[model samples]
Target: MGLGAGRPAATRGVLARVSTAVVVAGVLGLAGACAGGGGGGEGGQGRLAVGLLLPGGGASRFGQFDRPLIEQRVEELCPRCPAVAVAATPDPAVQRQQLESMITRGVDVLIIAAIDPKLLRPSVEAAHRAGIPVVAYDRLAQGPVAGYVTFDGAEVGRLQAEALLQAMAARGKGEQIVMMNGATSDPNAGWFKEGSLAVLKGTAVKIGKSYDTVGWRPENAFVNMRGAVAALGGGSIDGVLAANDSLAGAVISALNATEVRPLPPVTGQDADLAAVQRIVRGEQYMTVYKPFKPAADAAVDMAVALGQGRPVGSIATRTVDSATTEDIPSVLLPSVAVTVGNIKDTVVKDGMYTIDQVCPPRLRSACDKAGLTG
Candidate 1:
């Protein structure tokens, strides 16, 4: 959620380049697929209509990584597929409206990253009533959805917890750590919370207090951090378990506002550039680095396959049942943990970010220290 959220221009440029490559991949695969289906039109042979909905638009990763990548994959898997994407940022009402629109449009399949997993149930149920399939994207959207596609969210939390504990031990101080989790409305947030708690069960570190961050907003995290600081005394916190990089930023900012030198270790996710820089400066401990390419590509492939009336069973690794349905074809991807020491191996080598962006003049020294720039 954190990678390049503010700069739309740079994010759009990155998407433009990557989308072009995705298109090329799509055309080659799609043409071959249709040829094998006989010299008929895409739909005349096996055309499929698919619908997609995502939770947010503010994150650069969504438009830059998920949208075009999924579109291209659909093209590759289903030459004659028609796909529509309707999504918004943190607006459950808008998402509900979009779901209804998708249903009214009579799409054959639905893929959704639910804005509110619970509130979106009625629409998912309606899709089932109409005989359409649903694939829960990312957060295991609730209702009669067919399948679920996402990385191991619990593992993401575990990584952050492990890294924070490691950082705490390095200080050799038995101080308390504060947990700032994501929104309660999100299933992944709960999964992440459970994972982190599992890791910290027997540690010497005592929990001072925890808060469920709403909207995953930097401001919300900031306010929460301020509260924690006031309640526990500014310097009492040994570490912060910020659910993601955005929260980590807020935590660091709040801590710095108190005139604290060398901020306590904080855990984060999404591997946002700012967080990466923080890691370089030794302000944040770690973040979860999810390769958006694979996650994006897998969703695209599944959506496209659904659109083509082809068997997604050929591609998907497993089948999951949501509250409303079961046995929907899906793909679950893998993720990695990012720290200053391995930025080059994860985001850099994957071409998610260029050295220029990460190693700006101000961050040059930090990059060198982190082995990010030669």
Candidate 2:
């Protein structure tokens, strides 16, 4: 089950980076004002206790970028505040428990990338009743969230679908492509799928098979891809719209296993190092790069403001409505489409990943051929 579908939302303010000086002064001033323990909300206690919860951590972009970046920004803004409490898990029940425990510990504000948005509603509500402000990060939680931050998901899907169609141009009309979508439990998955369908519908590309990958797991994607191959036949499938780099790798693996000669182009997101290498090696077509710094900085600003009992409208550039909430203040960031041609210009230039990380020794020749090493 998914949250009730709501109005289409875009992070219309992607170009406007977070104004750190203004946000920092606002937070610190508010904290100082509340130093006498005035009624400034949950953070009126002088120093706020911020808790962060992410869906996944180990080796995922959350750990590689979001976590450290968020922590660093929080420290820079609130040098005297207690260190942000952090937890990561792919399990919704466990995440709920973690959130509840944070609430019990009296954290003033929370930033959560929910594993299951619907299941976390009760926890979010409970926090609301307990006077803690919840900031929805990455995934929107279904409750009274104070602020939201994430990339433009629809743009991500549109970019992937467009890249796929361009790659499959040789097939001309009626190209059969499989849609390897994300977990149905995630709202962003629905948005991505809808965005891609909007583009693919007008084209001659036919969606041969679509799978809502369980838990966004690579192994589940691999199993589904194998099933797709057996059912659709390897020769008939022209492209695969794998939702992220992990799934794209799985899709490519399944195709390799079935020995699909001259493998069809596969689309992915999250410019993971492995995905960049795969793009250079000509195994995958492209991935979406959503710069983590701006998103993290914005999230921290929102968290700090909410923690100190300040209005996030100053920090939020636009508004988004989740299934249960309407006109929630939000910061929507933009994403870039990355391919072999712009690997250096996009990811490397942005410092998301160094050339050595993307190239590695095994991919030296491929990197050279892609003009990344040369």
Candidate 3:
């Protein structure tokens, strides 16, 4: 979908200027709902039953950060809230079954980050039919989603593309970059791709090859990157715009395997620890750092309010439209561009990672050169 063409007027303003102050001010409004004893709920006389579903677990950002953050926020907001039942998988069929199971068990509210939004629509519809509100987390699942929370995908792409352009400029040889995007099933991937194209197309950059990595899998990315190398003749590939850190890692590995000397600049998202280390080692150009705390907090806030049979207007900073729904209440947080230059100021300062974590013993010299050390 185009960014601003059909969005609501209030949403357009948010799209125009999504800032930290605005996010804080908008989210603080949710506190009023919590102050009123978390409103009223139907789960065993005010104990809200929450269901949490993610696309991945174990080492993924959701496992390490989003889940814990959301769980903690739920506890702080509603001490009497039932322990949130959580499930995660990268398979759409499994995720759909999980949501259906939650609906059958009669959870008061569900927070889901769908592995494949389209495939999960029937389940989201089932939840709606069962009078259970589904709060779409990170990824905007189709159907009657009551609320949504995520970073601006377009802004993320813009940042990566702009950074790649700057890095490619240093080469002074060519302006051709391969685009390694996320799965087509992911709507955010399209947003990121469109956003990046908006920037790159306006410039002299020529896209040598572009592939949508299936399932956002590293193996898929490896194959695609290797093919791009073979097709474009490694030396002609000026840069790479891998959608996220996982794919970026694969792209780097493939390039190395192909013996592409003096690696071209690469861009990534999610600010994965390995990606950050790569940046320090001067192997990657930049990664988009989407602050997960605000997103998790907003999702939890929305879930609690929804479970209590309250409207999310108080919590949502803006409204968004999905293919199956329109004007869905949403909290779209801003993101930062992280590179070797501001690792400390962006990710480290936010406590997303400690200096010790990003600067390991083996990376001591690179860390020192990047000014990440004390």
lDDT of 2: 0.80
Pick by lDDT: 1 or 2, better one:
2
Q: What would the per-residue lDDT of candidate 3 be over residues 187-244, giving only the tens digit for each residue?
A: 8888899889989886888999999888899999999999999999999999999999
* lDDT-best of 1 and 3: 3
- Per-model TM-score, in order, reads 0.83, 0.88, 0.89
Better of 1 and 2 by TM-score: 2
Assess the local accuracy of residue 214 in candidate 3 as a C-alpha lDDT between 0 and 100: 81
What lDDT, from 0 to 1, does candidate 3 have? 0.81
Weakest 10 consecutive residues, lDDT, candidate 3?
21-30
lDDT sort, best first: 3, 2, 1
Among all windows of 10 consecutive residues in model 2, the one with the lowest summed lDDT is 20-29
The residue ranges of model 1 lying beyond 4 angstroms of the native Cα positions read 1-46, 78-86, 309-311, 319-329
Q: lDDT tens string, model 2, 198-223?
A: 88987777889999898899999999
C-alpha lDDT of residue 218 in model 2: 95
lDDT of 2 at 159: 95
Could you tell me the lDDT of residue 347 within candidate 2?
A: 93
Superposition error at 250 for model 2 (Å): 0.8
